[model samples]
Target chain A: MLRLIGIGLNPKKHMTLEALEKINDSDEIYLELYTSRIVDMTLDELENLINRKITLLDRKTIESEFLVERSRKMKVSLLVPGDPIIATTHIGLVISSIQNNVEYEIINGISVQCVVPSILGLQNYKFGRSVSIPFPEYDYYPESVYNFVLENRKLGLHTLVFLDLRESLEMSALMGIDILLKMESMYRKDAIDKNTIIAVISKAGSEKQRAIADKIERIKERDLGPTPHIMVIIGSLHYMELEALKKLASFPENENINLL
Target chain B: MLRLIGIGLNPKKHMTLEALEKINDSDEIYLELYTSRIVDMTLDELENLINRKITLLDRKTIESEFLVERSRKMKVSLLVPGDPIIATTHIGLVISSIQNNVEYEIINGISVQCVVPSILGLQNYKFGRSVSIPFPEYDYYPESVYNFVLENRKLGLHTLVFLDLRESLEMSALMGIDILLKMESMYRKDAIDKNTIIAVISKAGSEKQRAIADKIERIKERDLGPTPHIMVIIGSLHYMELEALKKLASFPENENINLL
Candidate 1:
């Protein structure tokens, strides 16, 4: 039997009781962290809670069939960060499991997509399709994200931008802002402008989780601590939403003259 | 101190350890079921788990300062269904708490919005603005949901329609489909037609979770069973998503000629 468990944002506090029971039952447990990062959770703490040693599944090991072989022999659990069971790679593995007739279960986690908008007091219903800002490596920069924001803006819907995270390199909110600014310079479609206001959420779902809103230009230079941050481009704002940001975090709503 | 605790989808097993710990620590505990529902969880089970007397909050009492007055004195936990912290009403309460000089914390949950897409194996990024179909009263049928679906279809984005839930009424997937079909007949828009394919998810995130996909006309008469069902009007089906639905549950892919 194989279980794909969702270990939420803060591993120690956010993982559900059901997830904990599954972790305790599994004979072999593996944590996949390449897709996301847990800022507050340590392996020692998780080990103490589950009372079992967890093997880290890196890019190389994940490519191997150690997990599949173990599933055939014994009960195995693959822990993914922030509700990744639906991810393409995980879906492929599940399909493989079904073809091989290996039973499996998906324990849903507290997805970051759900938490970020909520934490910032933005109505989740108003959000359009979310986009990811990939690290511009090897002179390759995808302007698709700008197009997404443009499409969302056209409909007066908010866009949630997830920063890309590579091996040992987590993109910060500032970096993501820089990329968007650069994309704006290239496209010049008026999707991203200096006068436009955006929300930068840092260390989301952690104790240090913070939401800051300001003009695009000012927010681009702000250093928002440890990585795995999310940036939200505001297409339209309700009065209560702006007030929520003002009350909950540092939002320079008054400074953004282009909001109108 | 105040804690907006997220008691997840299934009351029996979905809530996190952190939520339980906070519930134990708080002097007052309240469960707000107005926003969402836990299908299989009983009040007894929840109260037994936390070992505290749980108070229920409805719309009438939620508007009062009863919670605020209590929070000013001792630690309180407003246990919300799914994730209530981001909820507008909950945010209003939190704002009042801050004004009253009360410290609060937001504990996230396994939101249905996130899990439905995950369980259906649809990429989370493909979803556009979510729509809610209010239970139409006498001569109050709203066609806003059709507009949402129309807009999403324009961008080839999936529309997640949340069926409205009232105290005495729990809108089922069948009812939501009926409303949409009624709208299509009234508006004569091509957005929702007999040929449109949709995915119906019943009791999502629970042990008895079920997902089915078929044409609109076929699904309208299909009895999905129980309340609190989510309907997804698929835009562009990715190969992996269609495959996941084909493999996981009863999805009549071939029956829909218009799917091509």
Candidate 2:
């Protein structure tokens, strides 16, 4: 039997009792580190907390079905940071299990996508399409994500921008800002100026997680002190949202508050 | 000082150690049931678990400035089910606190909006606008939700339909199916066939929570015990998503597997 367990978004304590039990019961534990990571705990920290030696699986092992096929003969727990099914790639593993006639179970955990919005005081329902902004490759950054944010704003909806992070490197919020600045340039010549409300959230689901909302330019200058950040672009704001931004995010005076 | 404490989607165990510590430290704990609820535990259960009595706050107390002003003078912890800020109304509260010069802190928790999609194996990024389907108002059901689903489908996105539950009422998956059938009828003339792929998720974030995927017609006929349910109308499926649905959701094979 194959088990897909969610290690949750942040640290070892974020895991539920049931998830912990499953990890202990499994003969072999494999962790996929590509899609997401626990900022509060390293693999060594997790190993010490769970008291089990876990083998780390790279993207190739996850995508190529190398471990999944072997799981049919052994009770293996595939640990994914956050909820296992949030990423499309993990869903692929479940599908391969079905094709290989392997029975499996999914253990749920907190997802950063959900935690980010909640931390930033954005209503989950009011959000439009969520897009991932990939890093610039060979002097090229895609405009599709920028266009998506632009269209969502036209419709008076908020946009959640996910930043790309390499598997081997620590995740950072700077990548998210970089993507936003690129998107802001597409908006207008003065797009990166202080009027826009952008929230940078890091280490979501962890106790020490931070969410800061401010003008895009100001955010660029602040030291967020972390990786794995998500940026939110607020198109239109309700009176309350504006107040939260002003108080928590330090919204500057003279900025348009008549958005509602 | 005002404290926004998230009680989480389930009852007491769902609350993190940090949240529990804050609640214990507060002079007054007020429970706000209007925004969301705890499915796994009741008020008495929560009280017993926390070893403290909590004052219940209605929508009026939250909306008006009475609670906001009162909180300024005392160490008040306003308890909200799920995360504190996923709802626009909660953000409004934060704004109000700021306007009144009330120092406040937000203690985040697991939200169903995020937990549901993670359990259902749906891509969080591919979801469009989320809408709540209120219980049929005097047999006059609104078709706007159906139209939303249709539009999301056209965009190849998923729709998360939150089934409405009255205060003090127990919610179940059957009510969710009823709403879906009503929605299905608006799209087609027939008595809402059951073969459409729909997921019935109940007690999300709880240990014994349940999730099943089948045709809407079949789902309606089957008995899903208990309240706090959500229906997902899946549109275009990626290869991995389709596989996860079949394995995890138990989706029927007749549905198209490949995207053009």
Candidate 3:
């Protein structure tokens, strides 16, 4: 039997009561940190709370037949950062478990998906398709992020731009903005310009959560403080949304902010 | 200070450890039940766990100045089903709190938006705009729903059809499909037909959660059991998604389901 649980945004603040019980019941507990980071707790703190030695699984281990073998014989629980199935890879793993006739359960938790909008006091319905902005590999700069922004902007919907997190190196919002700016110049499309107001949110759903709303050009120079940052490209903002940004988050003075 | 907490889907299985602690620490605990229901636990069971009598607030009470007034001077925790800020009205309230200088904290939980996709093994990236189907109020069939389906289908994206949950009456998937069918006839846009494959999910994120995929006409005959039923309009499906529906969920035999 395999139990996949989401510990939510903050380890101390968000673990569900059922997740805690499952951690106790499982014969072996493994934390899959390759996908996302646990922003709050350390491995020692987590181990202390669970009262068990937790084995951390890298990508190689997770992709191997080790999890399947262990689950087939003993109760195994894999702890995910957010909701277990938010990532397509996790969904693929569950499908694999189904093929192996392994009984499994998914315990969902809070992801940056809804929490980011909630923290900013924006309507979830207004958010369109979310896209990830990865660190450009040699001669492989993806334009999916730019395309997603353009599509969302056309529908007057907000776009959630997730900066890529690779191992210990997480892409910064400044670099993400730089990529978009470069993409704009290369494509020569007016999807993202200097005047565009972008919201850079860091450590969302955590105690140190910070949000900054400013023009893209201006944001490229500003430090967003720490890793795990996401950007929201502004579409048509409601008056209340504008007000929420102004009151709760840092929004620069701009007369042309309300496109709605 | 006011803390708006989402108790997740199932009370017994989904409530977070932090949510429970906040419920105990709050000067006043109010359960907002107008937007969504707690499918697994009764009111008595919830109250028993909290060790405090919770006042259930109706729509009128929630919209009124009661919550804001109470939170102004005391620590109030409003227990909302699923994520606290998933609803737009909650965003409005939080904005009001900000205007009144009332400090508030939002605790995120497992939302149906992510959970449904996770349960059905549908890629979240493929989900387009989500729309709710309200019961027709005699000569008031919303063309917006028809338009949304057409738009989403054009983009090759799945649509999450949320059934309207009026005060005491929760609309089922069968009734929702009926509304969409009538709208299609009225608009004649070819958005959805009798042969359209829809995923009817009931009691989502619960232990007895059931998902059935079939043509609309066949789904209308079967009882999905209980309130809080949601439907997913299929778009392009990955091979793994088709396999998930066949193995994880109950789907009628269809060669056309694999759109990968």
Candidate 4:
């Protein structure tokens, strides 16, 4: 039987007991690192924690023929960061398992989309369509993200912007800031003004996770001190939300005046 | 200091180590049951597992004056099911804390939005705005939810429909199916016909969690035997997604023929 186990977003301890049990029960364990990464622990740490030698599966190994065939014969546990099915690639694996007649089970994990709003003091229902800003390819970046944020602004909904990260390379919060800044400029010149509120959340689900709220320019200039960050550009704020932004996020005094 | 901690969508085990730590560190833990209920564990079960006594908070306690004053003087943790900020009431509390000058922190949790796509074989990025279908009020149900789903269909984006739950009741998968059936009639008479794929996810993030995909009418007729469920009305399906839906969701061959 094939198993899709969510290793969660933070570290080894973030995994559910049932997920851990499934990992221990599996004959072969494969870890996928492309979609999301564990911030607090290493492969060695996970190995030690789970007491099993795990084979690290990159995108190629997962999509390859050998792994697919092997999964059918053995009880294999494919560990994914965050929830297993969040990425389309993993969904493809499940589909392949179906075609191959491999029985499988999926174990859920903590998702960053749920984590970001809580860390940033934004309402989840108030959020619009989430957009991921990937590295610009050949001076061609999608304006759909900008349009989404603008639409959210029109409806007074918050926008959660997930930044791009490569498996081999570390992508920092600065990348997210740069994308937001560019998007702001492309959408509206005064978008980064004092009245604007943006929350920079880094290392979410990790022990050292940091969430700070400020104007777009200030957030851009500030050092959030980590890779794997998400930004929330808030639109309309209720009286309580405005206050939470001020206290938890350190909203500026002048900004508070306008909000009040 | 006031802290809003998300216990995730399922059970006690779904919480991250950091979230667990925050819950342990708090002087008092208040759980708001009106907005959402934990499908996996009871308050007593959580108390025994976490080794802490949890105080239950109603809507009045969360919105009234006592919580604000109590939060300021003490380290308070407000426990929520799913992500803390997903519900409007939690956002109101965060705002209240800010207005009262209470220092606060948000401990993130896993949400169903991130979980649904993986299990149901839908694209996370291809989802439009999420809306809730409240129980009929004064013989007039809002068409806003229908419009949202219709718009999502037009845009080829999936719509996550949250079924209404009574404040004191446990809402399970069967309720979700009922809502889907209601929605199908409202949108299109033939919408509930065979080949119309709808995913009914119940007790997500918990060991007892279950997901099934079928026609809206069939799903409604079947006894799903659980609560706290959501419905996903799929739009355009990718090849892999379609396969996953068929394999993982147990779609009948006749249903596939209907789609063709």
Measured by lDDT, the strongest candidate is: 3
Predicted structure with the largest DockQ when compared to the true one: 1
Q: Write model 2 residue lDDT over A1-260, tens digit each, in one string.
A: 78888776764545654567788889899998888777777789999878899999878777897767778788899988877877778777776777888888776666676666556666677787788877677856666677677656765678887777785554355666665676677655332345667877766666666777776657777766466676788877876666656666556655655566
List DockQ, one per candidate, in order.
Answer: 0.70, 0.46, 0.67, 0.50
* Position A37, candidate 3: lDDT: 77
Prediction 1 TM-score vs. true: 0.95
Task: Output the better candidate (2/4) by TM-score.
Answer: 4
Which candidate has the highest TM-score of all?
A: 3
Give me the chain B TM-score of candidate 1.
0.93
The weakest ten consecutive residues by lDDT in model 4 chain A span A251-260
Stretches of candidate 1 above 4 Å error? A63-65, A221-223, A256-260, B221-223, B253-260
Sort by DockQ, best first: 1, 3, 4, 2
Q: Write the per-residue lDDT of candidate 2 for residues B105-211, one digit (tens) a residue.
A: 77766677667766767778788878787767687677766666665666667777777767776446576667667667666643235545677776676766777
Range of the 10 consecutive residues with the lowest summed lDDT in candidate 4 chain B: B251-260
Candidate 1 lDDT over residue span A124-221, tens digit each: 98899999899888967687778888889887788988888888787888878888888888888888687667888888877888778877767756
Per-prediction TM-score: 0.95, 0.82, 0.96, 0.83
Q: Each candidate: fraction of true contacts kept?
A: 0.70, 0.54, 0.54, 0.64
The reply for model 2, stretches above 4 Å from the true place, is A24-27, A64-75, A100-103, A168-196, A202-210, A214-226, B24-30, B51-57, B61-76, B136-150, B169-197, B203-208, B214-226, B257-260
lDDT of 2 at B240: 64
Clashes in each model (backbone N, CA, C under 3 Å)?
A: 0, 11, 0, 8
Tell me the tens digit of each residue's lDDT in model 3 across B1-260.
87888888776777877888888889998888877777778899998877799988888888877888899999998899988987877887887887788988887877788688878888777777788888787778888778878877766678998888877788888888878888888999889888787898888866678988877768777667666798899877777778777766677645465476
Poorest 10 consecutive residues by lDDT, candidate 3 chain B: B251-260
Clashing pairs in 3: none
